[model samples]
Target: MKINKLLILAALPMIGLTANAQDKGPQKNDFTVAATVSYNNTVMQNAAVGTLPSYNGFQAQSTNWNDKSLQVGIEGGWFFLDEWKLVLGGGMSITKHPGYSGVPGSADSDESFEWGDVPSYGAVADQNFVQFNVYTGVDRYFKTKVDGLYLYAGARVGYAYGRNISFTDDEYNMGKSVGEAFNVRGALTGGVEYYITDGLFVGAQVDPFAYTYNRSLIKPQEGLSNLDANSHNYSILAAPTIKIGFKF
Candidate 1:
């Protein structure tokens, strides 16, 4: 079921690529399908867990929070009504930050594991998300040329779906309150996009914040007092992109 949903999101861009070509008309009504490439450094983002326990009996804390990460994706759109375009697209992203060394065994939690799988396995005590975006929004253009660059801005909303979060046995018992997954997540996103050309764009977007709803989450863990003490959040992000596209 999860794989199918992901496939649907990943294949959305093709709808625009198959549209019939519009002759001259307003040109804005033309559709576009461009392969895009983008890279961004997540220099800073802050999260706060509820509060940490004075006891050192358990292994707890969110993974490295300030580490840098990278994202690359492809996006395309269909302009059905000249000025209004429905953008349905998706891409993949990876985090550069490696997680804690291993799932140290303990009396309360007996889970054990190797350290190398931290990032890829996502099976340890770490907080990270991996997913893509398929958004739809209205774009209004005001400029001089059909293919030339134009400045524009608009609202976008989409559904975010992924298994992006998981847990290892060693990560159990450390929940702010109780019954929190190694990671828990759901998708929600909104942001803006700009056109450098009818087929190219530069955009910045963010997913809605994730909520653990655990009391302990409201309470800080050792390394992540900022999380519960403040808030531990992960998001589905698609941004700081320089993607070139084309109309079919």
Candidate 2:
């Protein structure tokens, strides 16, 4: 009888563990990692206005912090509570614009290009951009009626650095045009995730909207003076991204 009682006591703990393992809910100390990426060739609408003047050789240009065409990111989070997570992540973005024709032989004075008013004398004009960002945030998750489905909302704040370069035809002998920009950004994020199986999930997320403050310094060619500009802007932006995540 004592042997049977011992066996039952040992099995009780295993039975409890099995029951706990079957519960597929977020728990304290659970860690998760996820990836987000997107690609599109479409031009951005409502790009930030440039600090430099629009000229034949120099087009008005600025960083569009919300542009997502060229983006790749990875994030990881720790569940401090069953319903709340602390997350950290970073991303990179890039854009390219090509083939701008400048006015013929209009820029004759040094001051013309300095104020960004010089007419272009080159046949080839283009601009390219790249940006990097890192962020941290907290997310709150809520369980729905359906099993393995959770809805989440969060807020994030991050810093971004962006670089843009304008190119003119070599024959024009114009100075290089480059703009270096920085942004302080914040956004609200929300998403729905459906766990395909325990510890694995697929979901979609979007920022819904965001605000950014931008500062840009323009070097409009080696000879011309540098320009400083700042802007405060709010944009209605929703960039939806698919996600795959694992929890342990």
TM-score of each: 0.38, 0.60
Model 2 agreement with the true structure over 179-200: per-residue lDDT tens digits: 7767677889898888776788
List residue ranges in candidate 2 displaced over 4 A.
Answer: 1-22, 38-67, 92-131, 164-178, 221-224
Candidate achieving the largest lDDT: 2
User: How does candidate 1 fare on TM-score?
Assistant: 0.38
Clashing pairs in 2: none
- Cand. 1 Cα-lDDT: 0.40
